[model samples]
Each structure stands twice: as structure tokens, then as C-alpha cells.
Target: MPEALAILQKYWQHDTFRSLQKEIIDSVLSGHDTFALMPTGGGKSICFQVPALMNEGICLVVSPLVALMKDQVANLQNRGIKGIALTGGIKQDEIIDLLDNCQYGNYKFLYVSPERLQSDWILDRIKNLSINLITIDEAHCVSQWGHDFRPAYLKISELKKHFPKIPFLALTATATPRVKEDIITELGMHNPVQFEKSFARKNIAYMVFEVEDKLFKIEQILKKNPQPSIIYVRNRKSCLEISSQLQTLGFKATFYHGGLTSREKDKNMQLWMEEKAQVIVATNAFGMGIDKPNVKTVIHIQLPENIENYYQEAGRSGRNGEKAFAVLLTSPSDSIQAESQFINVLPDKAFLMSMYNKLCNYLQIAYGEGINEEFTFNLNHFCHKYGFPTLKTYNAIQFLDGQGIITFLKEFSEKITLQFLIPSKEVIRYTSLNPNDEEIILTILRTYPGIYEIQAAFNLPLIAKKSHHSEAEILAVLHKLNEKGIIDYHSKNNDAVLIFNEIREDERTINKVSKHLIRQNELKKEQLQSVLNYVAEKNTCKSKMILNYFGEKATTNCGICSYCITQAKPKKDFSTLSNKIMALLQNEDLSSREIQNKTKNTADDVIFVLQQLLEDNFLIIQNNNKYTLKT
Candidate 1:
């Protein structure tokens, strides 16, 4: 414990565990299966990270996020800990060698994405190593009701069957009461201890703006607060468009989406981290495992899918525990859009069957024979091929995944280099080499360090720089070396290809309805409530509402929200918003979009006034969608 504390103080600069971390750690120490529900920015990693070092054997962490798995492994390596992550980005043999280290050497941890759990070699070999703790990060994915669900998570429970005596831990940043219960029940945890921290960030002020021109509203928001920010959009195209627009406006902006190549993602992320890019317009894929402090604002140009997602995105702000802002720029059609999202979630059994049939039929699949089949699913191509609408088709696939009928993953290719260098004689003798002139031969061994010491990945650029060679030269060197029976490499930039195993029907039948659909619905309603709470708050305390949402009973208000800002005003006397129509018309006659943008009132009131204007002949609709003062 003392050593752990000292290490924490040196590395993370913290002295002790926060909230239930100690108890959770103790539970694992006692060999109990523990479930931790720490919110985003809360210390989920440390719970397992600390314990892994203290325990006798390595801890096997199963995570769903591929980038996060890589990140954690990288971070541990950075901190001088012996860790390895088995991602497709590395060659299969490297994974096998890493596993060998876990069994025989000082390797303390192995992080793997859940999808790898089903691999035949992984499953068979993992049991040979003495695993002290097994942790499932994002445990909520195991629940059928989570917004970010993955079919791969279902295999976690089977670990108990394999390692009956090993301690188990499940961790997630977001989960409702129902999902929490489902996690425990599904995983069959043994009298697990539950620890849930407050999800609220009191220093972050949540505000919503209804605007006609979203880009204009976003621009105004940037002008108003004007600090390092993240603009989250719903899709890749929007991420591209908004990022370009922000760049054009002279703001240093970058974008991230699933569409970007690994190299592009890494470069953009590095720029953002260095603060060279002040704004990152991204789809939801950008935030996990990112710990950027001093992010002054988080703007959602389109509403996020739920409050859990919103809270997570917003929590990225004020991480320094300083005051920051989380603004949601709303369009008039937002409500309808929310409903449309829900519409996709609530597909019936027929829709499920039809969608499944279409996919199978398109592939020329024959009923039960198509079971366990894998195919490269290109969403746009599939939709266009079958003349299906994009959103609905996407939703149908998600619904199928929720029911545990199919699996869908965006493509991931891997690039890897060894940090551990084998002796030149060993490399030559191990493969019984034939050629002395192989350039790739000497490049790889010197690039990595002590082979016997179990090194992980090294930076490719650093290797190239040290070797006095260009990147292409390094690549060619590694390629030849891999072919010359020296080392191996994994390339992930390749297209998405599916692999099927066992070609059998699904083991269990589902109701075609998952609790995820219901929970997602309730979550949307909860987000709407959050928006309502922000707008209708009369008390000066915005912090209290957020606390309440996180199940915290913070009785006192922080007195710094929009509510507090507006509370000092004498209540508006706009009894009917009944100012002289002349007061509103004081400006050059405004268009309906303009008039609506300027008011604090609802659409009904805005339209009611426009009607009165028409009654008094105070306004005129001229030249299509424009409105103006009467001539």
C-alpha cells in the first residue's frame, strides 16, 4: 500500500484513492468479483492498475474500446510498467510471445479487446497463466440496455467457467439502475460490492441555445466564451464540415471520426494535445481515454443521444476543476430529430427479420447455413445496393447486434514494431537465415531494446530518425525482415473483412427486443429533462440539478449558472410577451428565423405574435421564405 501510494504520488500526483477505490481494491484483494460504477473522469483505471501491481500474478483486463486498450498499454509502458495489449494492430505471433511473457516472466498486465476473447488460441492459452484479477472495462456494454453496446462483451461471463478462482472486476462510466442490475446478474458476480460516484461536474455550466442558423450560433458561442473547446457533431460529414468552417474562421481546428486513417487520427490527436489546435470537431469516437485538462468549453452542435453521453462529453470540461461551459446549440427541428433517432431504435420483429434477410439475401446466403458468417459490411454500399435509407439501415444492424444475432465493427488495422531487440545471432540462428545482405535484418533489432526484458511497442519515427533513414526506408526494412524469418508486423489499414466460425445457428433465441432500446428511450427523455431543467431553473443554483441527476444529494446551489446569472433581474414583465409590437419591430423587419432566434420564449408565443402582426398588418411575407415590415 505504501509503495502504491508513493508511485501514485510520483506519477499521478495523488496521495490516496477517491470515493470507493480503496474498498473496491480491498474487495479484489479478498478475491471477490467487484463491479465499479465510477463516472467519467473518475478513477476507473487506477482501481485495477493499483491492484495489478500489488497482486501475485498478472491482471487480464478485457476492454471493448480498441483505442483505449492500446492507450492504456502505452501509458503503462510509458510509466515503466511491464504491460502488453493484444490488438489486431500487432502480428499474431507477437501476441503469442506476449502471452508467453505473461506466463513465464515479469509481465504484470495484459489488456485485450473483448472481441479477441473468442479467439481459439487466446481462449486456450489464457488459462495456462495465473491471472489474479480479471477486469471488464465499460461493463455496461455487457448489459443489453446500454447506448454503446457491443456483442463481444457477452463472453466475459464465460471467464468464470474458465477461471473459477480468479477475482473478477467490472467497471463502467455510465449505467442506469437497470443496467447496473443487469451487469451483476449477467456476470454472475459473487456478492459484489457496488461503488457509484457522483457524475456531476459542478464547475461546468450547462446551457442550451435554440437558433435558426446553427453555424452562426456556433460562431457566436465561440466568440462569447472563446476558449479551448470541442464541438461534437453526430456524423463524420458534420465533423468535417464544422472543422473546416472553424479553420476558415481563423480558429486552429482539427477533426476526428472513424473514417480517418490511423496515421491521420494520431497526427490530429497530437496537435490537439499540444494545444496547436484549439478546437476539435469530432464524432463521439474522439473522447474515450483522452485526459485533456484545461478544456474550457464543450459544445454540442447537435444534441447527443442521451444524458449519459452528454454528461461524459461535458465532464471532459472543468477537469482541472476550474469553471468551464457546456453549451448545446439547438435547432428547431431537434425534437423531431430526437424522435427520429428513437424511431430507429424501436424496430419490430418483422423489421429485424427483413433486415437480416436482406443482408443474407444480398450475400446469397442460405438460411441457417449462413450462421457464423463474416462479411465486410460497407454501410453506404449496402444501403445503396439494397436501396435502403441510410439511418434506418444502420439502426437495423444495431438492433440485430443488441439481440446478439450479429456483430458489426468499424474496420481496425494495426501497425506494430518491437521495442525488445533480440541478439543478431539469435535472429540469424532462430530462423536459420540464408541471406547476409538483408537490410531489414539489422534495422529491427536495434530499433527495439533488450529482447529478454520483454519490451512492447516503440515509436516508428524515433526508430527511423535514429537509423538515419526515411520512413519508407524503415518500412521496407521491416517488410524484408518480416519476410526473412526475423520479425513480424501487423498492418490494419486494410479493408474490413469478416471471418465466420462454426457456421452454426445462434445458440439462443431473443425476444428481438432489448432493454437497451427501452433504456435509450428513457435516457433521451432524461436529456430532454436536463434541457428543461436548464431553461426553467428559477433558483440561482445550476449545480444542484446536475448533482441530483448523478444521484448526489447536494442540497445547496453553487450560485454560478445561467440561472444565477439571470436571477438578479426583476422578473420579466412580458406578461404576454405583450410588449408593444413596435418594441420587437424596432429593428428592421426581421425574418421568422431571425425573430425566433432573438426571443427567449417558445414557438407558440413567437408564432402568436407573428399572427397578431399579420392581424394588424404589421408584417409581410415577401419573396418566398422571407418576412419584412409592411410597406
Candidate 2:
């Protein structure tokens, strides 16, 4: 147990664990099933990672997001630790090889998507491995009570049957008490030790402004802060539209969404990360695994469907312990839009069954024939071909996903592979003959080994930067190499993958999960109503309200929140202050603070009066600070 701290300091370069992180790790090390409810950025990974490094056997991490697992595995690899991830997009041979490496190659961690656990072959191989810890990331997804429940997560408990002795750790950024109990029960966790950190992010000042002009409010926020920020919108179109508007306002901005290609996503993220762009306009897809610590503001252009989602998204700010703002900009129609987006559009049981049938027909899968099969799904194409509304159809698929009839695996960025056809000696000779292509050829030869024999994953943007060329130029060179028989290139960029969990089920089978769908939709509407109530709430302290929702008792008001600051205090009346201000400013100009001293009134009252005076043409603001008679 003493060596655990050494391992953490050695690998993570940290002096000590965050609050409760060490305790959670110690509980797991002592072989207890653990459920950790750490807020986002609360060092949840360390709870499992440190213990994995200290223990003898490999730690199996089951996560829902492929990109997140890939990023973590790559980070581990960079730290000289061996790790592999198995997701839908991985090739079969690659999976075999990766599993083999985990079994014999001293791999400390193996990350797998929950859907991949359905494979009997994978289970068979996993049973043979000496597993020590089973960690489930986003464990909330397993519970029907959770906001993002996925039915495939239920299969995680199956691993317990195979390895009865292995300890399990389930973690999520946000989970209500009901969801917590469900995770514990569904995972078959026996008296698991639970650890929860306070969900309050004191550094983030939660704000909600019901504004008529969202863009104008956004502009004001950006201009006031002007630090690295993220602006979250509802859809891809808004991502682009808002980003362009910000650019038009003379701010350096970029947009990201699930619709963009992997290369484009990476390029745009890099631009923001490197400070080339001051703001990133994006959908909710943009925040996971993004570690930009200096973000000063996170503004939501629309309300999220639930408080859990909103809290997690807003928590992305102020990671470096600096004061930051999380502001939600709401229009009159935002509540209506949110209801339509999340609640009203949720397909009923009939729609779910019909969509399921249509999906089976669309994929040409006969009843009892498509179990455990994976397909390249184009939702837009499917909707257009069948005359289904895209949003409703997608939501129905999501409903189906939660019911375990199908697994909706989102898009994962694929790796590009290149294999050389020309011999090594011939490559040098060709480069000498073709000086223009010399840098790229030399770079490929230097960076990727055995390219002449087998395809190796290559990063196009990385290679371009190394060779001091553009990605387009490097791609052109690769294409030229292919044409000249110098190399064979395979770029593996593709859309989301859908896997059928059961054979095409009839109405009876689909109806079993229909109740779950109805319950889920009902819970979603309840959550939406809660958010609307929070937005419309004017008396409660903002921080206290949010903290209470997460089951924390917040006794003291967060005095800095917008609500606390705006709450009327006992003081001189506003009209009196307004008249005093006008009399004070009749002859000489004065700044706000000067006026405040002269009037001996509360600062809020003075400021309120000043604003009314300016609005009513009783005074004029000049030089950005002084106020005088309007005359």
C-alpha cells in the first residue's frame, strides 16, 4: 500500500491523490467492489490507474466511448505503460493481437467497450487472463434510471460470473441516488464501498440569463472575458453558424461537432488548444478528454435536457482553480425547443416497434438472423430512404439502444495505414530522382518501420508537420506514391457502427423493452422540467440549488453567484438614489465608485439607479466610467 504513492508519483508526477482518490484506490486494492461518484475532473481515472500500477495483473476498463478509451490508452502508452483498447472499429486480427499482448506482453490495462463484451470469443479469452480489477467508466449508463442508459451495460455483470474473485470499480461523473443504487445492484456488487466527492465547483459561477438576443449576450461575454472558452450549441449547424458569427465579430473562433471528420475535429481542436483560436463553438461532443485548463468561460447557447448533463458540461471550466463562469443563455423558445428536442420527440411504443421492424427490413435482416452482427449505419440515409424524420428516428434508435435490442455505437476516428511496395534501396534512388517528394519519402521511411512489408498506422497531420508540408500536400504525395506503385495507403475513416444485440425480434420482443422506454422518457421530461424550474427560479441561491440537486447540503449562500448579488438588500430606495445621483451629477461628472461614496448608498442600489438614469436620459456615461447630466 505504501508503494502505491510511489507509483503515482513515478508515473503521474503527482505528489498525492486528490480528495478520496487514495481511499477509493485503497479499497479496490483491498479487494472490495467500489462505486466512486467523482465529479468531472475529479481524478476518477487515478482511482483505478494507481491501483492497476500497484497490482500484479492487468486492469480491465469497460467504457462506452471509444475515443475516450483510445485517448487514455495512448496516454498510458506514452507514459511507458502498455495498454490496448477494443472497440467496434478495431479489426478482428488487431483484436486478437491486442488480446494476445494483454495475456502475455505485460500489459497493465485493457480497455473495452461494453458492447464488445457480448462476444463469446472475447469472453472466453478474457476468462483466461489473470484479471485483477474491473473498472466501469460511466457506470450510470447501465441503469435505466440514468440519463444516458445503454442496455449493453447490463452485460458487465456477466463478467462477475466468470471471474468471481476480481474486484470491480464503477465510476461516473454524475448520478442521482436512485441511479447509484441501481448501478450497485445491477453490477452485482457485493457491499461495495462507495466514495462521493462534493459536486460543487466553487470556481465556476453558475449563471442563467433569459435574454432576447442570445448572440448579443454571447458577444458581451466573449468581449468581457476574452480568454479561451467553449460555446456549446444544440446542433452541428449552430456550431458553424455561431462560430461564423463570432468570427464576424472579430474574434478568433472555430467550431466542432460529431458530424465533422476525424481530421477536421483534431485540426479544429488543435487550433483552439494551441491558442490560435480563442474560442471553440461546439456541441456537447467537444468536451470529453479535452484538458485545456485555462478555459475562462463556458456558455451554453441552449439548455441541456437534464441537470446531470448541464453540470458536467459546465464543470469543464475552471479546471486550473481559477475563477471562471458557466453561463446558460436562454431565449423564450428555448424551453419549448428543449422539450421538442428531448421529450416530445421521444417515440412511443408503437414507433419503437415500427422503427425496429423498419430497421430490420432496411438492413435486410430476417427474424432470428442478425444477432451479434455489426453494420455500418447511416442514420440520415436510412431516414431519407424510409421517409422517417431524422431527429425522431434517431431518438427512437436511442430508445432501442437503451432497451438492449440494439447497440448504437457512435463514430470513432480510425487510423490510417501505409505499406510500401518499393524496396528500401529503390526508395532512396527514387527520392534522389524526385527531390520534390524527398522530405515526405524520407519521413515515411524514418518514422514507420517495415512499411515495405506491412501496413502501419500513420498520422497524416503529424507527418505533414514533421515534413514541413500541408496535410493536403502529404496526402497528395501518398496518392502519388500509390499511383507510382511506391506504397499502398488505406485510410479508415468511417461513420458510426450499429450492432444488433438480438436476432431481429418481433413485436413481442420489442414490446418487452417498451416499458423501459416509456419510463426513461418520463424521467427525461421530469428532468427537463427541473431544469426549466431552475432557470425560472429567482429566489434560491444558484449554487445551493445545484448542490442540493446532487444530494449535497449547501447551507451558506454562494455570495458571488448572480442570484446572491442580485437579491435585493435593505437600503435607501432606488428613486431616492436616482434623485441623489442626478443631483450629484448636475454640474460635475463622476465615476460609479465616486457616486457611490457621495450618495452613501448600497453599491447595488447605486448601480441600479445609475443604469435607470442612463436608460431614462437623466445621465450620460462618458469615457467608459464617468456619468454626467444628459443635457
For model 2, the stretches where C-alpha displacement exceeds 4 angstroms are: 91-93, 409-494, 568-631
Candidate 2 TM-score over all chains jointly: 0.80
RMSD of every prediction: 9.4, 7.5
Any residue pairs clashing in model 2, and if so which?
Answer: none
Scored against the true structure, residue 116 in model 2 reaches a CA lDDT of 80
The digit string of per-residue lDDT tens for model 2 on 97-206 reads 99999999999999998878878898899988989899999999989889888777998999999888899999999998889999999999999998989988888889
Which pairs clash in the backbone of model 1?
Answer: 89-414, 145-516, 413-492, 414-492, 419-449
Return the top candidate by TM-score. 2
> Relative to the unseen true structure, what is the C-alpha lDDT of residue 37 in candidate 2, on a scale of 0 to 100?
97
Please, what are the lDDT tens digits per residue for candidate 1 over residues 274-332? 98998899998889788888988898887666677878888888788888988777654
lDDT by candidate, in order shown: 0.71, 0.86
* Winning model by lDDT: 2
